[model samples]
Target: DKYTGQPLHNAVVWLDLRTTELAKELAKEGGQDRFRHVTGLPISTYFSAVKLLWLMRNDPAVAGAIREGRAMFGTIDTWLLWKMSGGHSAGGVHATDVTNASRTMLMDLKSCEWHEQTCKELGIPPEILPEIRSCSEVFG
Candidate 1:
């Protein structure tokens, strides 16, 4: 939530299993290994992706923000980097590295980029995803 100091939704930790059902639902779409080949991960709550899907489905505020284009999605590293660069008030940097992006299950491992098709399938809007950059890139 680089756009605001206080985010509407709290971070969903990796250990949370609340999205297990959501993952199962996703698996039903293309099997658990649906995105495994591209993301190197299966559809599971172990990643950030399904957690986000849960939020959007169950939380009206989150869904509204995303629908209105007021939401920005990313993992911890992206948030830290954005804040370090001045946050929303200072036109914070909105980006993430392949490593963090990969954990979201939103990235195409091979291209080190957001997988738009997968995002669509999962109901995640790519417009809200952070830019994918190399780990070596200077964010500041």
Candidate 2:
């Protein structure tokens, strides 16, 4: 969730390709194996982190919101859980299952926590990340 504890709007859709350039840059910096060992993910626009980075760089609204402590991000599941659990208006659960978080290229494949180095490298604040959870447990 955001530092303000609010849910931000217009989550970067996972399929958006706006992050292609940034993805290429990341790949060049570390090759495919850099984060692959920890996240099992190559630097690609397909991941949530890449998309988030793109939004932060290209969309002023998103960037401003984030800097203002008014942003958050997640996969479709995270958004769904937030809404279903009552959202910020209530106290929606800001969480995601490991399987989903793993797909985001943010979670550490080993410990299932937000990878600090990766987040710093990508300039994505760890606060915007959702809580990691097991797939079998109730999220909210």
Candidate 3:
């Protein structure tokens, strides 16, 4: 979290299986097409959104931080940017490049924007996600 400069939960790796059942449940709701139309990806635990949702449901510290507005979710690129830029001092830039953002299963494949409806369905707070930036742009 930005407030504490400490991670709310242990870093959930890409292969983590904690979100497997959640992914299956999400898939049952509308299958991969539900997400593929906008995100060009399937509803799977391999993505960031599902992992974050797992934290939201299973980790009290993470959930509380998110509810209290201290959480700042991002992929590895964003974390590097935030820390390299300023990181809780001066001015940390919470942002990620298009490639990284797109893989989160949250960004719209066409508009390159966060898909709000998908976020709501997964109980993900929009604010937790970082600003999406072009890969070639100056991040800091």
Give the alpha carbon lDDT tens digit for every residue of 6-106 in model 3: 77777889989989999998889988667888899998889999999888888999889988999999988888889889898757999998998899999
Worst 10 residues of 1 by lDDT: 1-10
Per-prediction tally of clashes: 0, 0, 0
Q: TM-score: which candidate is best?
A: 3
Ranking by lDDT: 3, 1, 2
Off by over 4 Å in 2: 1-14
TM-score of each: 0.94, 0.89, 0.96
- Model 1, 35-115: lDDT tens digits are 999999988889988998999999898998888778887788878877888888998888988888888888898888889
Minimum summed lDDT over a 10-residue window in model 2 is located at: 1-10
**What is candidate 2's local distance difference test score?**
0.82
The runs of at least 3 residues in candidate 3 whose Cα sits more than 4 Å from the true structure, single-residue gaps closed, are none
